[model samples]
Target chain A: MTLIQFLAIGLTILILLKTISDFKKNRINLLAFLFWTGLWSSVIIVAALPQITMPLAKISGLERGIDVVVYFAIVFIFFLLFKIIAKLEKIEYEITQIVRKNALQKQNNRPQKKI
Target chain B: MTKLIVIIPAYNEAKTIGNVIQGVKKYTDNIIVIDDGSKDNTYQTALQSGAKVYRHQINRGLGGALGTGIEAALLNDGDIIVTLDADGQHNPNEIPNLIKPIIKGKADIVIGSRFLKNQSMPFFRRLGNYFFNLMTFIFFGIYTTDSQSGMRAFNKKVAQNLKIYTNKMEVSSEIIKQVRANQFRLKETHIKAIYTPYSLAKGQGFFVGLKTLGKLLILKLTQ
Candidate 1:
């Protein structure tokens, strides 16, 4: 096996172990745990047997097996980034609502000044 | 007599907030200053100026502050609500003109347009306003001479129906969008802008304007 393949396999195994640990600690839900496990396991398979991606590359009209993986990785990363942005926006909106409610409640409790 | 409540959303405007409150006091006794987590003494100054003050513990930007101010005004039984900048750029004396349409049952929302009177504004600022006006029209299919005007008067019904979702300078555009969506009667009146070094130093810059446009686009997509 090539040095790159050895390193890729090792890194993916470490990531998969971490994902399992997170699932065990209830840090991620079953769906999330399954997603990460499937993703990393595929990465391990692709790294260990580069020939397995040949059919995927041919069907996707890519020149090489690695090209198929790279394209998928790029698209997946973009999807994750979009999800993160939407989640952050929702969190910000919620925070503003809480702050507004607190400010109004505090103001209401104060002595009413003749306006 | 309509109970007019003036809401001034201020952030670090201690220098001018007191004067702004006092100016608005000439028009209406119901003045509300939303100190959007100012690190200064804006709250105390507004209070000392005899205006009701509500303060956010952390800054939530212009939209958030306006939302709070509108809710507070509605709670206090305000018949009409006016929003003015705390930077003292908006003339409180002209506030009577702004609310006149609402009182006369003509307009549900009146925007104080600086462009209507041929007032002298910085060339770039005018150009920027035109650009944002076009953007507002493009995004929400609503056109206005001054989509970014800080001074606006709306009746209690409009205030209760309006929803401010953004928390930044883009709130100006969002307000225009909401007016279009709710099909409220809108009017524009000429009002002179008081330009001072301090006031000029506070509003949206070129980059902030671009950011506002970007946020407005996102708002359109998400909502």
Candidate 2:
């Protein structure tokens, strides 16, 4: 095998081990573990061959395989970032509600001031 | 008299919140203040001023605080909910004019319009008002004067149905958006916005206006 192919195999093996470890520790659900394992296995296949992505690139109307990977990588990273931001906003909103509820409870205990 | 409740959303208005609570007290005894995590002494001052006070652990901006205040007012059996700023920009005396139409059953929602009269409102602020007004017309296909008015009065139905998701100054315009969407009978009365250097500084800046528009648009499209 070529040096580049050997390096890809090593990297995919590392990812596979990490995914399996996470699954064993119950840090990730079965579906997530399966997804990561499948993803890394696919990478191992493509990295060893370097020709599988060509068909994908052609189907996606891209000229080069690496270009297709780059485009999809950008899109996936951006989608993940958007989801993180939305989750953060929701958490902040829930925290606001909790704080507001606690404050109201405290205020409710105090007698209404008669002016 | 109607069970009128004054809801004030204050953020870091320690210096002027007491006077606002007192001013509203002159007209009605039921007052609710939502202190949006003020680092200053706004919570104690409003509570001491005889208004029921709720505090947020962190600053939630004008929109978040207003949402909390509205919920509290509805729970407190407020027949008519009148909202005003904690800063002294809104004249509490004009509150009667705002809720008059609601009290008379002429309108379901009454809003205080600063542009209805000739006042010393700054030139850029007026221009900004027109900008958002035109945007509202384009997006919602509804035309109304002073879309960003802070002083407003509405009934329990509105309080029960109106959804507030924003956590910033955009809450003012969101109120108009939701009112139009819900098809509530809206009234515009000529009321003055007391403008001072401090009030102006507390008001939304030019960049904040743009950010509010972006947020409102996102809210419209996504949810």
Candidate 3:
């Protein structure tokens, strides 16, 4: 297979994995999926294409396959971190809303009683 | 005005619980000292110090002790709750610093950080703290200089929802993770940490940190 074909297959696999995650989490958003899929595809293409890949790799002083894999792993981990943070933020907001509403209801339900 | 209750988790600190309890008297009369199932005279010393003491009947680790202490404090009318180590490493004179942020309505929880300033700590101890702080920051984006500090203050609302299940030293990580998840306002204050040779050697070893992270990962995955 050609380098471009390998890049295409790898990018497609990453997109499929991400899509599976989004589906499992029930967070389907067309624009976000398209953006991430395109981003990863470009990254794979940029790393796999021989003509541009070697020169860029030499210029940046990064080894061929290992450096690319390392960079990809780092970026993937950061993306996962942000996704976790977003989920935590959502939960925090929901909890705060429920607590506030509960407090308000309790305050309203209080009656004037002789102490 | 928020009423404050000091929860001192004493574990065989009979030699020091008396001074610790007496030390906190000027600040607040409401204090709960959990004897943590100490085999020594911990309960007797605490009672002599004029604190309402409760016995756990068995050793429940520091986290469990703190949980029991918080519950007792709340039942005793705690509006703001502070947890202090009974080993005397924590200076009760600095109690006000721990609780001031809550009083100012700025933070729901305030943690006393030993490394927040130029406090003297052992070499290995400092290195361990730096490592854990980095791990915590990388995982949660919440950078606390001293994640293992024993002095902490929490308001009533936070105190109510503070469920600590990690019955050991790992509870420190669990505490920060919960704080981040709950989005509670956090404030760190520079406080002095008195570390004797004994206390320095008592710090968690490297394997303990790794085990704590492993437990944390398992809990996260299971949850």
> TM per model?
0.94, 0.86, 0.64
Candidate 1 per-residue C-alpha lDDT over A1-115 given as tens digits, one digit per residue, 9 for 90 to 100: 9999999999999999999999999999999998899999999999998998898888988888889898989999988887786777778789999999999999878855956
Residues B62-99, candidate 3: write the lDDT tens digits: 76677767766666668999888887787888989888
lDDT of 2 by residue, A1-115 (tens): 7998899899889989999999999999999998889878887887787776898778888887867876877998888777776776677668777877877787678756632
In model 1, which residue pairs have backbone atoms overlapping below 3 Å? none
Best first by DockQ, ranked: 1, 2, 3
lDDT of 1 at B133: 94
Residues B139-221 of candidate 2 have per-residue lDDT tens digits of 66667788888899998888988888778877777787888889989999988888888899998789988987887675565
Best to worst by lDDT, what's the order? 1, 2, 3
lDDT of 1 by residue, B1-223 (tens): 6798999999999999989988887888899889999999898898899988999999999999999999999988999999999999998999989999999999999999988868888888999999999999999988999999999999998999999889998998999999989999999999999999888889788999988888887788778
Docking outcome class, model 1: medium
Q: DockQ for model 3?
A: 0.02
What's model 1's lDDT at B203?
A: 76
Assess candidate 2 and give its lDDT.
0.84
Whole-model alpha-carbon lDDT for candidate 3: 0.74
Model 1, residue B146: distance off in Å is: 1.6
